[model samples]
Target: MASKCGLLLFVATIQVLIVAAAVFNGIRSGYTKVPTGQFNSNIDQILLGQNSIERILWDDFQKTPELTAFFVTENPVKTIANGAFQRTPKLERLGLRGCQLTGFPNLVYVHGSLIELHMSNNLITKFTREDVHGFTKLQMLDLSRNPIASFPDMRYILPSLKTFNMQGIGFNCCLPLYQLKHPVLVIDAAPCAYPDHITDRLCLLESRFRKFRWNHRLEIKAGYSSSLGGTACQEGIFGPTCSH
Candidate 1:
């Protein structure tokens, strides 16, 4: 009788241990299957392409606080739904080049930590003053190869902007070149002249445009000038009308 009781007690203990092990394994599996919302809450940077991205289903990203950088480039078939990143708080750098975007997406409500923005090679035609008002900390902006015809009011630019690239675009007149404030390193104002205008007058002045070298100052080549007679002009014309 004593031996049977001892055997029964040992079996019960072993069964309890097995049950405990099974319960722990179940908990581990459940944790592993937690949704991405809880898993990616602390993600700082995300690079997503069209194949893996469904903008409509990703509307839950507004809750994430640590998200700082985002690179979004979608295919022609995939459209980025509006309001996709309206509420991301810590977002800083955004690159959306070659995304086939027609108009500017609404990003006015994002937090003010944004520093770098690259939106080159798009089809953007218009930009309001208020579209870029909230980006106080913006340092770099690339609007190359777009269809913007003119610059908005000077006050629309962020005060802390360091580098601004608007090359390969169209500008109506020389108004933007004269209005832009200091610290503008490059302006690519080559396209600011009309067909009939004096190319030298429209050319960016070498005095106004300076090139810096290490421990030395470099002389920038001035645009061409056209003389009344057949004699070669003072400086060659710099606009499209000038003969190469």
Candidate 2:
């Protein structure tokens, strides 16, 4: 009876060891090479055993050629940290809607390949010329619901920009019409109000009038006063001085 009991205990110990080995092997097999392809369906396969991605290193994953579009809905990835997607040359579309980003990142490196950028519902307050300068191929830029205050320069516009939505973004100052280089298909500058009386038309008129007086003064200095029709001596109408 004693021998039978010892034998049974020995069998049970072997079974436990075998089960443990199998479980360990299964776990190791589950972490095998992740495939790469265009539009990788296994992108979110590795959850890092957590609900959100705390960190993402491309080198750790297999590369997929079809990964042109990336949609990040995870709240923990609110702001795209610097160098997050810096080396992805083939990336074309990036959607970060509802991310709590406080401002726009310097994406001049990705401007060459990025076509559509959706950053709506963010906390961006400003856009510098260098921020959008290299995106010559960009088509759609959604900056709606932000806190942008001004358009610093017009040189940042890409030739392919078709849709620009700036609605709900506060620009407490005058909207510069000259900032638009190409004909925009749609612009949601609706909520923006003209804070002053100087519309584009008024500014143009003022500029042209100043240029005319400057030319008149140059002509007068060149002995062409006959064009003044003897009114050059009129009070407060001196050459170029009338520009004031």
- Please tell me which predicted candidate would have the highest lDDT against the true structure: 1
Q: Residue by residue across 1-244, what tens digits does model 2's lDDT show?
A: 9999999999999988754442111112232222122223323212212124333344432343334555443233334455555546666877665656776865654778888988777778778776788788888888777777765534346777777766665444333333422244233433444453323221122432211211122221212232433323111222121211
Q: Any runs in candidate 1 off by more than 4 Å, and if so which? A: 1-39, 49-60, 77-82, 153-156, 174-176, 180-182, 193-244
Predicted structure 2, TM vs. truth: 0.53
RMSD of 1: 14.2
lDDT of all predictions = 0.53, 0.49
lDDT of 1 by residue, 178-208 (tens): 2333344345544553433433232333444
List where candidate 2 sits over 4 angstroms from the true fold. Answer: 1-66, 73-76, 153-156, 180-182, 185-190, 193-244
Model 1 clashing residue pairs (backbone): 224-235, 224-236, 224-237, 225-235, 225-236, 225-237
Show the colliding residue pairs in model 2: 38-66, 39-66
lDDT of 2 at 207: 39
